[model samples]
Target: MTLAIETFHYRLAHPGYCAIPGAHPGQMVGSGQLFKRHESLLASPDPRRLDLRASLLDPFNHYRVKVFQQHSKIDVLVIADLSASMSIPGGATKLQIAADFLLSCAQSAFESGDNFGFIGCGHGIEKKWLFPKGLRMGRVQELARDLSRVRSGQGGNGLFQVEPYLPLRRSLVFLLSDFHFDLNRLSRLAGLFGRHAVVPLVLWDPAEYADLPEWGIVKFQDSENRRTRTLLMRPGLKRKIIEAYEQRRDRLRHGLRSKGAEPVFIEGRYEASALTNYFLQRVV
Candidate 1:
């Protein structure tokens, strides 16, 4: 049953985001180098630009993203998956990292003279979608404020209701999700890519990558569904589980490639620069 998404007016700006600990001067590379790594951005990565982008990270938090705007008339939409699963034990759950990334990107867009907005979705049809376009920094503040308070519940994959909202503009979209959801409805990704430059960020925790568990039998509850299930892990079972996971990953990759949508794997545990580098250096 599809329920109408109650669209409420939520503002942006997070007190915590501002107070988030700052980084030391020499701990990281120059920001211009980060952007320059992506050939599509600037001629070179200037240290000055790197300083601003690098500040998005909390000195204590390792998850950080840098957003740059090279095109106007083009949009930069940040969609974060806020499913219940993202609330698990971790410094910054995939959801939080995504949210922070969006905030950082909004700031970058504002600086680059492009319009930006954000959408947070979970297991339902309705979503807290914000489409703040044009050269408006207020939108960034609105996005930050609204996202800080979002909560997630388990339900259907976010792919269903997302189709109607595609190509909000002939702009670029960054959809970040744990991606442990359904894939049959992946056509929406294809459609979004067809119209706009879209990238599907498959966010996965290290634990999710390899179903690691202590020796004893432990009952595990579904992240999306609270139901608990027992699994006896034999060598054969473990192999099958790992193989199935790999196959699913490959399938999604193939599906997106078929649709012309670039799929990037994002490991939530460590800093993965492959995709970000691709975004920054590959496209011209």
Candidate 2:
């Protein structure tokens, strides 16, 4: 089936709380908003920003200085899992869904005056997919096209290699992955986002657990290992598969949360508006 890609608008949930210094002039509190009075300064005071009334009111005529808030810009980065699991044949492949989501984020960041970047990881990170700062809308579209053509392969947590490419300053990071890798390895990866605003998008397919036919033999393959196995599809077996997936979900959520990351689970397709709403709620 053709993928139904939806586009939606988004805004930063919190516009004033970025820890790293930003370059763009904005309403956020920073060192760039001049001509604004904050408090008194005992050491050096700027004559231009001196409060005449406050200085005159003081018995000793102590000077009061005006402080300006700086305008800051944030970097938006989209990190995708390009492992074999993401290439599953179905209504919408995980990578395809990720490309659409990345497009939405690019649009949102562009509108909000933030730089956009993208990185794809499979066996190791794909350097071709890395779009650094100052990416235009046309460039984003080009990257999306390239993303659709890349193939998945055996990769053991290639995401761990992405840390070096990240911006030196704090950034708004969106991670798209199935989280099918070893759970123990996830904590190390999650810790990398401790100082940044991170959103983990978990892409799950219904066929992974819910599409099994009753009372039939089926073949299963491990996407990462390329190992195949045959098993009988029974009600009890299906139930167990689903239960195992749920347990893994819980573990993933807990593991990520422990490292200051929250996982947003999405099945089948993604809605940009829903994602924006989720960010709005979380940021507030």
Candidate 3:
């Protein structure tokens, strides 16, 4: 069955630094509709954009030409954490949400005339899940299918090795994960992606913390290490568990903000409109 992919809108926070022309505001001066400034013809050397009035008014009598800001394209990438913990199901599996999110990104990027890429990392960068920047919808769909099948029992240590695969030029990067690991690793990863605009998609499930029973015996397994433990769920324990999750949320928020990344927390299921709203508010 074909998955339904919802497309969302986004814009770069700053002018694109890339030279390849496409559809985002850029610092490059070229043949675009937005006029930047008038420059001497000797410098700009574009007779077609010559300003006769400005040339005539020049105190030094130098020919003038108009310079316009050009629109440039940027790479859009999704770097997802495929650790075992991401497979835990609540309303939907985290990996399923991730795949849907990836589809949205791919569709959106394609509509916006930008190249999109995917990188799914676990213990290390998985070659099967690495896709370089491209505009092929077929490849994107294939990658999404592959992502949905992943059930890694490894940690997200491979994130450290992703820098080499990323574009050298600044791009918009979506980092998707449950982030059950150490915050220090997040800080380090943020530093590694310092050149790019990083948006952290924090995936969580209600079953993981919010919807626990107040009186029952619950068995929990560590997704990464395959360790199992049984706990008697009582009112006090439930409160403590929820409080712990809350504390972790605070830390993740602060950590991401400190590293100049604004995180979007997704609980239960993924929605395309929520992300679209984030970009809208950010642009505003």
Candidate 4:
């Protein structure tokens, strides 16, 4: 099915370490607009960048060549939770939102001359949903379509196994999940992703907590373990439930911040502009 994808602008706060030439500021010297420093012609060996005035004024009479920081490409990977909980629908199904976000990432990465990849994790890293970093927009679109049709059934423990699949170099990783599982697991995952820049997109539905009726019998099910519980809802009980959700949000935010990751909580729907604003306000 066709999906409406919205692209967002992003930038690395620090110089990228990739050797491949692309669009972001990099640590390598190459053909770029950002002038780094001047080097001896023998070192840089690029006559086109030779500074005539610097060459003439050299006390040692050595030809000085201008060296500019080379622009580089970084792998942009989306590590999504494909657990049963993610199948819950709010304004949109969580998986559908994830698919849309993936499409946007692919489009944005391509526009920025970067590579895009995706990994969907459930009980383990789902091989059917894995893609290595590449610049092909067609592959991304195809993958997004496939993702939209996925039937989530398992838990998200596969996230622990994702380290091997990730790029050895630093990358920008977008972690999409409702985070219904234990926060301790998230903390561990945060440690595993320390080498990469991680952005946690906390997907939540209002119906799960906020939209509950204050006076009625409520039935809730454990998506991961397939357990169900029925509770008599009242003002006091509803308040407690809302407070619990609020506490979870606080813990999530604090935990992510302590690990140097900023979490973006999407209560009902996904917004590309919110993500763009996040990068603008926090990444720098």
Candidate 5:
């Protein structure tokens, strides 16, 4: 699908999240008018946020930004998991949530004039697909539109092999996903740690980490499969389950730390506001 973009009746300098210390961003551009764009997943057009989400967009919304000014421009690569198991229900799918985080990153990149691009990967690509490279303010929407259609297909292993695209030289890359996959992916992840600045985003739902209400027997289906599994949830069992979840989380964190790369966590409840706030505090 093609993207449609025209300078709105209004214009403003778009700053990303916030300016880095000692890094001076450029000018200010106010909100522009609303317009329609075909989203990646749905059939109809949706209203794109031109400027209504100003607060969420940190320092950028108010100041000017210097594009790609870094002696070595941060190569911003946004990667998301489209694996089927990652399509857990609660709020948005993991892929969509990743897209939102990436969109925010893209916005910041655009304003800063950084070398930005993105790749939405899953099982495999038929025909061919383009991994966007270079900062283009308009391409952020193009990415959201593309991401809306990501399908999580059921398979023996929903996890993907993300090794080939690694060792980005002096670049900052963010890999956002639920990461309920095989540890085999980590060998390559280690290489990434040695070479690039990798920010790992861990997406989770409350149900995965804690117990729901003690509302009696709950019929639940595995997020990876459609089959239903009924299980009784008592207070004791709930505590045990939560403990086990915590243990696993600690293990994951330990593993990443050992290999390198600090993981930033965001739960489904974060929504866009919390998500943006986290980015501002961490990456911006």
Candidate 6:
């Protein structure tokens, strides 16, 4: 679907933007950057930024002042899951959905003048999957190209590997994944990300649970191992399969909440408007 994406504003404890004088230039609730056009000398009153034109034009040269854009930029990171389960057949794969989400987020970040980075986690932290901090609008195009060739790999434990590279200060992190890993393992990983503002983007496909024939001998293949198993899809078994997915969803949501992170569940397709709403709703 044609999706409408929007950028959002979020308050952070640190987000690397401080009011105090810092080495890095960023948007924050801090004192930095000089404003153009001297409206009031009482504000900037900077002798260095004295606007001679306005000073000469002023009837009394009493209101010459400089204006400044006083917004701090925060880093935004997108951590995507590249595990085999994300490559499920018969629908837009999880990676495809994740790529779209990342693109939308990148657009939002750029519009807000924030830096954006990306980490595609699969089988471990591969060098190819790391997109370092960048702020240009073209960064999203590069990310999209990289994602176009990426497929779900056998790696499933990459989430735990992300903690080391996380931003030192508080940041807005969006983690996209199907989360088919061990519950205990996922919980621990969530705790690691709890240090920052983490939003888990849980991707699920209805076909993964609801497309099985009511009665048939279906051969299911494991994406990671490439192993196949035949199971009779009886009516009772179908119901159980669907129920299990529902339970899994609940656990994933609860786990994130318990760890001080929020979870957004996206089923089948990725809708930019819905994603935007999730961010807006969480603005408290």
lDDT of each: 0.54, 0.74, 0.86, 0.84, 0.54, 0.73
lDDT of 3 by residue, 1-284 (tens): 13678888988878998888988999999979999999999999989999999999999999999999999988999999888899875677888889889889999999888989988888898777788687488887877877777765777788777888998888899999999988877756755557888888999999988899999999999887788999999999999999999999999999888877789999977889999999988841
Better of 1 and 5 by TM-score: 5
TM-score of 2: 0.82
Kindly list the per-residue Cα lDDT of model 4 for residues 208-257, writing each as its tens digit.
88899989988898887778999999999888889999999999898888
209 in model 5: Cα distance from truth in Å?
4.0
Candidate maximizing TM-score: 3
Q: Candidate 1, residue 182: CA error in Å?
A: 2.8
Clashes of 3: 0
lDDT of 2 at 100: 82
Residue 43, candidate 4: C-alpha displacement in angstroms: 1.5
**Top of the candidates by lDDT:** 3
User: Candidate 2: minimum summed lDDT over ten consecutive residues — where?
Assistant: 1-10
* Global Cα lDDT for candidate 5: 0.54
Alpha-carbon deviation at 107 in model 5, angstroms: 0.5
Clashes of each: 16, 9, 0, 0, 15, 12
Q: Clashing residue pairs, candidate 4?
A: none
Comparing 4 and 6 by lDDT, which wins?
A: 4
Alpha carbon RMSD to native, model 6: 6.7
- Model 6 lDDT, residue 245, Cα: 94
Q: Candidate 1: minimum summed lDDT over ten consecutive residues — where?
A: 1-10
Better of 1 and 6 by TM-score: 6
